[model samples]
Target: MAGVILPRFYGCYNCRKRVALHDDIVNKDFVAGYRKRAYLFSHVMNVEAGNKTDRRLLSGVHMVADVHCGDCGVVLGWRYEKVYQEAQKYKESKTVLAKYKIVKLDYW
Candidate 1:
């Protein structure tokens, strides 16, 4: 599936609401020199409620694809993070969006 292009969508895990695909806040790079744009979605574990004592926590963002289904308008899945080395290469190259393909849609 190196050359295959998958569809994308932005789906809310809470209400299962989906919206049209949108631009991602950051760019990602995949294996074999593939690249795509993606956004961050905070997961339940990532969120921390305030406690009695003053304390801060480090939470990671759950990345999701910025896509929306055209027919039904449901978000497919959260975006996955790409390899660090590959992503760095893409960031340095500064290429066009057409250079890479949308490989997966993590629906479910």
Candidate 2:
């Protein structure tokens, strides 16, 4: 019961279509001493990444690809794959959204 995760519905801001669920994002176990990456808890959808493209996080770590709106092709955020230093093997995909670019409707 300690590790069970619940699903959350999030949509692409531009498309307004369901893209991803909460469980798709990864969270790691607590580790001490080493620097930890920034954690953002939000609804994410329609993200893309590539080996050729590069994005940087606040921690100065390079992310593999830019997260874009799948339907509208808007730059929504970035994806930090295995090379993110904090997380490995695309276990943790990261993204950031500008306030004006994203909105969450709480129907719950």
Estimate the TM-score of every prediction: 0.21, 0.49
lDDT of 1 by residue, 1-108 (tens): 798655454443333333323344243332221233333322211112221221111122222232333334333323233213443333321211211222222562
Q: Candidate 2: where are CA atoms >4 Å away? A: 1-7, 23-45, 82-100, 105-108
After the best TM-score superposition of candidate 2, give how far the Cα of residue 56 lies from its true spot, in angstroms: 3.8
Model 2, residue pairs in steric clash? 82-89
Name the lDDT value of residue 42 in candidate 2: 34
Q: Name the weakest run of 10 consecutive residues (lDDT summed) in model 1.
A: 43-52
Assess candidate 2 and give its TM-score to the true structure. 0.49
Q: Distance from true position, residue 46, model 2, in Å?
A: 3.9
Worst 10 residues of 2 by lDDT: 30-39
Question: How many clashing pairs per prediction, in order?
Answer: 9, 1
lDDT by residue (tens digit), candidate 2, 37-97: 3223234655554353544444455544656777777765455553546544343444444
Candidate 1 collision pairs: 9-67, 9-68, 10-67, 10-75, 11-75, 21-67, 21-68, 64-79, 65-79
